[model samples]
Target chain A: MIELQQINRIFTVGDQQVHALDHVDLSIQSGEYLSIMGPSGSGKSTLLNIIGLLDRPTSGTYLLEQHNVTSMNDDTLAHTRRNKIGFVFQFFQLLPRLTALENVELPMVLEGIPPAERRQAATETLNTMGLGERLHHRPDQLSGGQRQRVAIARATIMKPAVILADEPTGNLDRHSGKDVIELLEQLNKTNMTLIIVTHDPEIGLRATRQIRMVDGRVMEDNHKR
Target chain B: MNTPDFIRLTLTAITAHRLRTALTVLGISIGIAAVVLLTSIGEGIHRFVLSEFTQFGTTIIGINPGKATTAGGSIGVFGTERPLTIDDALALQRIPNVQAVVPVVQGNAEVEAKGRGRRTTVYGVTSGFPEAFRFDTAIGKFLPADDPQAPRALAVLGDKLRTELFGNENPMGQRIRIGGDRYRVVGAMQPKGQILGFDLDDTVYIPTRRAMQMFNRESLMEIDVMYREGTAEKIIVKDIKRILQARHGKEDFTITTQQQMLDVLSSVLNILTFAVGALGGISLLVGAVGIATIMTMAVRERTAEIGLLRALGAHQKQVLTLFLGEAVVLAAIGGFVGLAIGVLGAQLLHMALPAMPVHTPWIYVVFAEALAISIGLLAGVLPARHAAAMDPVTALRAE
Candidate 1:
């Protein structure tokens, strides 16, 4: 479960103050498939960043799993981010030098896992993503859809509680984008909390719960499918 | 992360830019090689000079006129000093443990031998000269032990002076004129090469009292006292001082022990070695600069990777260690390569110039490698800290 109350994110540009998030509040329960959809500069990405613990709110009281995460130290925030949250970027940010398996094994590697155990687990994870044959291929050598799948595998390798995808299919073709969305939906069916931030109405409508924002404020929330 | 994994990661990053890494390594290697080679030469010269000085014998003490005020800044040479005479030299021979005494009066003279005249240094010495200074006679014999006050007009030609004035012809029993005095060549000395630029093979020796009359001086320039081995230096110096002070009615002479001279010379040469080593260290400092520059550039290039590592739960300390590890590995490789090149270069130099002494001590070899590693650690600090301090969000967004 995640809760936000009176969360405000402000940006100072030279002499003026811009409110990226204007005193908005929202709540979500476990196993909810949700999407934050708005036009450009609607603060959807900022909200997602705050929820992912990548950035702190200017004024916020954020509670994730009944713990006040806004008051956590930087190191604790990093620990919580790695253990409780996962991210799939639109660009499929895989390190170019690492193979598909190595990219997926990175999270466990940072966790100080042994080489043999992590190697086996990363192989299985990549194999389940239908990248068994492409396990040794680098990102530069893989197809766009395959790269996105690798990124998805890397995100879920640590078995985090929630998955945050920011325009996960923005850079892919229609077919691969559909494949990525179906894979994500499959994970959602397994009771993983899935939150997506996108401008595409089709992708936004696929979520069981949808929220639309305007000028840093939540204008619409449709919780019933 | 575990050490192996951490090393692998660092190695991966270093090998990513092969050309850049090679260039950085080359910079550090050149510095280490410079340090090794320069210090090797300095140490070689240090030993060479010491052996040359000690070859003449180390137990001999020289008593020079005018007590030098070595303890404080004062001009003792300008004081009224009594000139040490042949009598002082004869008195020192009576002291216990005294082996031989040679009262010296050195002067340049034109010697005419075999109708050929040449200018050479003439040494006014006694019969104990050859034994006391370890000089050998290549032919005939040295000056015989005759009466000190009145002795034969015998001359011992130096090795080079024999070759110059006599050629292949035997100079023994030949008459040579030294400063308008005719003397018979009793012997020719064995070839002893130069000592501190003084040609030991180009000098002539005669009786001390005769040379004092030839140079026309009342006091001997110096009196050399040769003592038996294992004799304590303080006792010999004390006995010589007591006799000379009693005869002169004051302590007007300076007695210099060979050990004291050796200690002073050894310390001066050590400083010379350290100075050259420091000069080489300057280049090593430049190499450290090269490492710092490359590491800083690497940090800039890998900002996104750093952010990703942080996102994957790598701590700030981990990021710092990764960068520092890369630096240390680079420097260590360079150090090894530099050591090989330096030792090989020293061998090649010795082979090319056999007369030049070249020695590479093992301690310097070990120290040079350690210096390279420490330089790497020091150079990596600022850049590693900068990389570790980067904000994850901003770094991830960087192109």
Candidate 2:
């Protein structure tokens, strides 16, 4: 459902050129659970960002669901991202001023969904994440684990085909980290494709497809499924 | 996004920083209040002056002897300028829509009545002075319609002058001496208040021909012609000029219509109102700068949120509108508050000093509010554009 051909992401810092992603080629099918593991500056996050449509490669042709998304305009790209992809960041990215329910309703708000309906959907999604009683709690009021759960609810509210999570469990305690992985795996069981970028080997190895990147290139690709 | 949600979002951002928003709003309100208050006083004075001038009626024209033209050199009395006489005043009555014509000759002279004497303004005018100038008599009557070239030596005492000279005794039919000439008092005029510090109620009125002879002047100072309302001034002025030119064999008189004076007065007053309004606009400009500064800071502080909104599929226009909405709402609120304060302040001032005139036209109120909104739009544009143009990736990374 997603494809990239010879993607290159180069950054110019003053006089030197840095290749964040060099001649990278990758493809993923529907319902696939994948992980990109590498050290800092290995460009795993850059690759994930490229796949999420958050960053454009200097030279590449990207096809999402067989539509050429590489040459799409900014507004079209934004619309594609909204309808087909969801992102969960290491920082959770929940607006500090909004409650958990409101944070989860953000994507639908952008979609111009009716208030009563979006509110109902957000409540049910939070309830299923075991946050029924904490729906009105702000991010500052919730624990690290509960906040990640709210972020996950927010990401999946639009039912995007692919989820891009960059260090989703990086900020949580070990116990809560395990809980977040379990929640993501639970979504994978429902046929939602999930892609995780992490430095931790334990979490990285849980995916059906694991790829290790080094020096802006894929060093290893293993399929356990 | 829907309008309600958009407004709700903007309001949430504004309410997050309550103190800053309030201070910015206060800045704008003060500017608007100054505009309203100053313009009110300006407009009030405008109307007040106009009423004072128009009280004598607006359809009268004054023809003064000697052309008021800019001459190359001082000719003194050697210039062959014909004096406006009682015959010239009579010739003006031939014009269309002519109502009453009064030949005017004025001077200061000592008047003695019932053994009391004082110097006062003496107006040499015919019977039509009352009708031409809208002056009324309190007791008896105004000057009789005696012959303009040769009239009886009759006098009319002003309300104030009658009280000073007679002391409860009727001045009518009593003898008074004006410029060493004895005249019988015909009437006492009602109290017509002062105009521009000139005491109209402290003057005496006598026949124009008699005063012209008493003052030993060849010219009738001015010939005032009152015409029926709704007659175009140009027609009467042309007729007066033609007749005067024919009699004097040249245009030696300057005819001034009341409307022309009013037009000049109206323009001067308009400029005064605009000048004061512009002064208020300076403060409003400062308020606009305040809004711009606050909006810029807001955009800088909310970079991550803007990125989040963009990632959530909000258009650039939406982001721009969000920030602009905050600014416009701030200005609009300030405008309403300022309007209330300004109007209330003007009323309070009027009450505290009843002599000071104050009027706030509804148009100015509407304009002030509209100006506030425009200021918001102008000030918010740069910051809002900056916010909208920010890259989502870079903005999301901002702390």
Candidate 3:
């Protein structure tokens, strides 16, 4: 479960204050499949970043799983990000120097997991993603779809409680984007809380719960199921 | 992370930019090599001079005529004060722990024998010269212990002088004219080589009384006293001063102990070594600058990688340590390679020129390595700090 009350994110460009996320409030329960749809500068990505604990809200009381994270220190926030939330970037932010298997193993490495266990888990995870044959292939050597899948695998390797995807299919072909959407939907069906930020109406409508933002405020919320 | 994993991570990053890494390492290596090589030569010369000075025996003391301060610059010339006489040399023998005393007179004169003539250094010394100065006669006996006040016209040819004058023929009992005085050669000295540029093997030795006569001087040049081992120099020096002051009615002579000379020599040599090492350190500083430049570029180029590691839960200290470790490893390897090359080069030089001494003190090797590593660490600080302080969000968005 997640809760936000009066969240505001403001940025100063030169001398002007840009309200990236204005006074906003929202809530979601466990296992909810949610999609936030908005135009450019609608604060959807900013909201996702705030929820992922990568950036702090200017004025907010954000509660994740009944614990306040807004007031946590940077180290505590990083720990929370590592253990509780996973992020899928639009660019598939995989390290170019690492192979697909190494990319997946990175989270566990940071967690100080044993090498053998992390290796076995990474192999199994990549195999499940249909990338077992491409374990040692670097990101530059892989297709766009494969790279995205590797990023997805890396995001989920820590088994975080929530997955936040920001335009996960933005750089993919239509067929691969469909495959990615289906994969996320399948994870959502397994009762993992999934929140996707997207501009695609088709992907937006696929979620069981949908929220639309205009300017910096949430303008609509609808439940389709 | 575990040490091996951390090392592997750093190695991967360094190897990724192989040319840059090699160039940086080469800079450090060249600096270390210069330090090692120059210091080796400096230390070698230090030991060489020390040995050269000590070869005459370290317990010997030299007493020169006239108060060293009163005479100003012409202390050893005749009429400076009462010249040191043969009696002064005999009186020193009465002191405790005194082993042997030899009166010394020195001058350069032309020697003619078997129609061959050459100008060489001529030493006027007592018979105790062999035991006091550690010289030995190779073919015949040294100057007989005749009366110090009056002795026969006997001469001892140095190995080189004998070969030049007599051409390998037996020079014993052969008459040689030294500065217009004919003296029968009694012995030929073994090859004692050179000491501090003084050719010991290219000269001749005669009785000190006769040398004073030949040089037309009334005073003995110096009275050298060889003291026994285990006797403190202070006691020997005090005894010599007491008798000389008693006889001359004032301290009209300067007594220099070998230890005093050695102390001065070693201190001067130590400074030479340190100055050369410091000169080499300038090169090392340049190498450190090279490392700093390269590390700064690396931090800038790998900004995204740093962000990725940070995003994966790497602490700021961890990121700092990673870059720092890479720099240290680079310098450490370069230091070792340079040490090998430097020591090997020194050994080769020693082989090529056997006369030139080459010694590499082990302490300097350890110190040079430690200095190289510290240089690397210092050079890495700014860049590593910059890398560690980067904002993960901003870094990730950097592309």
Error of 2 at B288 (Å): 1.8
Candidate 2 per-residue C-alpha lDDT over B122-171 given as tens digits, one digit per residue, 9 for 90 to 100: 99998888888888999998889988888999999998899899978888
Span of ten consecutive residues with least summed lDDT in model 2 chain A: A77-86
- For this target, which candidate reaches the highest TM-score against the unseen true structure? 2
Give the chain A TM-score for each candidate.
0.98, 0.99, 0.98
lDDT of 1 by residue, B1-399 (tens): 788888887887888889998989988998999899888989999999899988879999999998766544455544667799888888899999999999999999898987898888999999888878998899999999888889899999999999999899999899999999999998999999988788888889998888888988887899999999999989999999999999998998888988999999999999998999899899889999999999999999888888777766677888899999989989988898888988998899999999888889999999999999999999998999999999877888777
Number of the top-ranking candidate, with DockQ as the measure: 2
lDDT at residue B393 of model 2 (Cα atoms)? 83
lDDT of 2 at A225: 52
Report how far residue A147 has shifted in candidate 3, in Å. 2.0
Instruction: Give the C-alpha miss distance for residue A10 in model 3, angstroms.
Output: 1.7
Candidate lDDT values, in order: 0.90, 0.91, 0.89
Question: What local lDDT score does residue A212 receive in model 3, on the 0 to 100 scale?
Answer: 97
Give per-residue lDDT, candidate 3, residue A216. 92
Arrange candidates, best lDDT first. Answer: 2, 1, 3
**How much is the TM-score of the A chain of model 1?**
0.98
DockQ pick, better of 1 and 2: 2
Candidate 3 has which clashing residue pairs, if any? none
Candidate 3, B101-214: lDDT as tens digits: 999999999999989999999999988999998889998999999998899999999999999999869998999999999999999999999876888999999999999998
